[model samples]
Target: MPSRSRYDVVIVGGGHNGLVAAAYLAGAGRRVAVLERLDAAGGAAVSGTPFPGVAARLSRFAYLVSLLPRRVVQDLGLRLELRRRPFASYTPTVRDGAPTGLLVGDGEERVRTSFTRLTGDEREYVAWRAFYARTGRLAGRVFPTLTEPLPSRAELRARVADEAVWSAVFERPLGETVEETFADDLVRGVVLTDALIGTFAHAHDPSLAQNRCFLYHVIGQGSGDWDVPVGGMGAVTGALLEAAVAAGAEIATGHEVTGIATDGRGAEVAWRTDAGEGVLGAGTVLVNASPSELARLLGEPGPPAPEGSQLKVNMLLRRLPALRDPAVDPREAFAGTFHVAEGYAELETAYREAAAGRPPTVPPSEVYCHSLTDPTILSPALAADGYHTMTLFGLHTPARLFSGDPADRERTRERLVADALAALDTHLAEPLADCLAVDADGRPCLEVRTPGDLEDELRLPGGHIFHGDLAFPHRAEEGEPADQAERWGVATGHRNVLLCGAGAVRGGGVSGVGGHNAAMAVLGR
Candidate 1:
């Protein structure tokens, strides 16, 4: 139980956003307390040693860092090292019965050569550069406003100042724009992957959910580069935990919040531990959980649980697998994202098939080898012996497919994993299974996480990674709310309680924008 019956602020969860809010508020000399249900904090952003007796510590759920703002790091004085990957991405394909692939990296000449080698001309490369140039401009304008009060849709469009770019990205469907810009199927698929990460939607879905997902993927820190957090994702939480504790914020793990009640002025938070139950009064409350969870605590009806749509697989490799194309080295190809079975037509077909209650004919996925970029995550012996780690994310595998009786779910899991691995084997010189590293128990060091697994382990309803459908990082088209807290995109039905998690506007990724905005709202900035 809490030492006292009251506090200046009571946070409902101890995820990274909650820790950030605690650090800011406590540093400002307000009594603050953070309650986490799990034994440790960090939520989805954590690392684990899954394979038995495996020395390699892998980033279990959330892997890379892109949306974390530089201001958060400097303000909290976090000790972190985010290293850039040497390459961008490599996608293997068969052209004219010959093995070939597209490789994108730092050198302009090299990239131009690769494009010319694949497409038999330079037109596609020029269009690729021009298309990203528009998103780059949008990123420069929109990313800076995340910490500020929500901007009206019209206001943000005006700030973008390029009507054509805004229309292509924000108004029209992403598929139409992509089809108009690129001719090559492989090239188009690579661009569309950004829109479909963790999202289940057709290319031309009228709701334009894909466009919102694509926008967040590209606008990180204005440059949109996803970097590896040295020492795995756990290091990020460690830094935040240290900062919050140093600022006098109390962290209470293994304390599950059961209910929250608030009138306009103050609130009471009730929680339970193994020992017993307790209640604490607070002048304010910040919820670092999903909107559905918050509604449960308030005893009110909430929206349907968001359905997650992806498969996460982690593996330890004794040696990197060989690629079909000999020109590109395995190290360079796996350094960044490695695309498989993600052609434009293939992605559309996969989405259509999965939507119709069938497994994807060709599962679209991407893989990354963080060990190539940052080897410190491995033991000294493993690193010296050429061991590497791989993280794979497969798309269009929705949570709905895994539902039914226990035996039915098992059959679904087996089929999906088999199809995904088969799709990957098409581009490799040898089967991926051949490169697996055996653990101390003489078992293959491979772990798979389905959406259902995430829901059970992390309390994520349906295991939706972003908590729910990603909203535009701005106010709605109709108008802005009159309440000050609502204007910051953190307000709930209750006045004293605010949302500080991925459910908040502009809170999709690992960014601390949600926490910062909520703090500003409470401080009446």
Candidate 2:
């Protein structure tokens, strides 16, 4: 079972980030070994058709791509393709029980008109644009620095220079900024939604995790657009997998890295596979698992379980549901992000209920029809059969909700599916369930993945998507270590260990910066 007694590096996980690290190190002629617990790599970035007999492929857990650097693509010689959606998002609003909506993107005039109709004024739209312009400036100055060494606080702030930018984002509660910036409650919520997505935190979280989440959500290569991987997320990961293998990196899936220890000479990785237990000697060990899980394997107490609050539901619709507002065609409406019951107060109410150990009556959620932008996800038979896919992500669904009695948690998640869909159905011309593509067993081609489901399936610490709560990218402010570790911001307390996953600084999303920076640290680049 052992290829050799030791390798130059033994990465503890085979996630995209780990693969990225291995690819780089191996390309530089270092012996690399990647050990993954599962039969497959890709971690959260994978695609599959879960519904039995459903011909349409769904992105499953993690859908879409943003923050993946173009440099990573070119450097690895990956043949991945990212297709941009023409429309950014279409949100339905109701007044007097009449369903109307704001269709953002497609055209500037239509977007402005939608805002005016909803607010009875054009004030909020102008403010929204001004807000982006400011963040745009900040993105320009900071986004480029992600792949390089981390900048100190003073250096970054001096780079930004604008007092308003610091006061609004880096220093204050994001809620105050959102509330102050947008006048209408719905408009404010649309902006605030980015702050809370997948994060079980309020807009006013003093820890500023919400701010960090918001920052990563927008700083997607300075464009802030989440592009659809043409053949689903699998293509992106598959390409990386190919590059890693081609570069002479050894990948062993189903080999769970169970322990790690470091010595003066080198580090050691202990893993369990079907064959038996084996220890791989390495000059350094790269851990791509969540810090909490990594800590456990290192025999240390991980931090208090990180909170993750999102319900992911995958469905195959026979046809796009008709929107109550026909001005925006259903195809155009669902082509981009779609919001449901996510008003500002609505979001707060849901967070309150979930924090109080109850699921919200109306869960704030968003949906994207990936097939709308990339029809390659659908088989010709399915596409001709009028099938499409919708991936819905619900907010304010903490791990605590599913941390209750096992039966109770199951029931709560089930109820959330009903409530979240009901919220979305309110804006549709017909019941969304009516468009379901049924399986041969007569079960609807739909699947729900709760936080509990994630913990069970992926070994994620609390199923937190960014591995842990999102952390600021830079080694800034007080209490940061001073050294080369601070430069890349990927080093661990152990000299020989480094993080190359979502827990690393700037590790959020599918960005390979964490892995790239980790390799740089090892290579002294």
Pick the lDDT winner: 1
Which candidate comes out best when scored by TM-score?
Answer: 1
Q: What is residue 297's positional error in candidate 1, in angstroms? A: 0.8
C-alpha RMSD (angstroms) for model 2? 1.5
lDDT of 1 at 99: 85
Q: Whole-model lDDT for model 2 versus the true structure?
A: 0.86
What lDDT tens digits, residue by residue, belong to model 1 across residues 345-425?
999999999999887878899999999999999999999999999999999999988999989988988888888989888
Global CA lDDT computed for model 1? 0.90
Which portions of model 1 miss their true places by more than 4 Å? 477-481
**lDDT of every predicted structure (CA atoms):** 0.90, 0.86
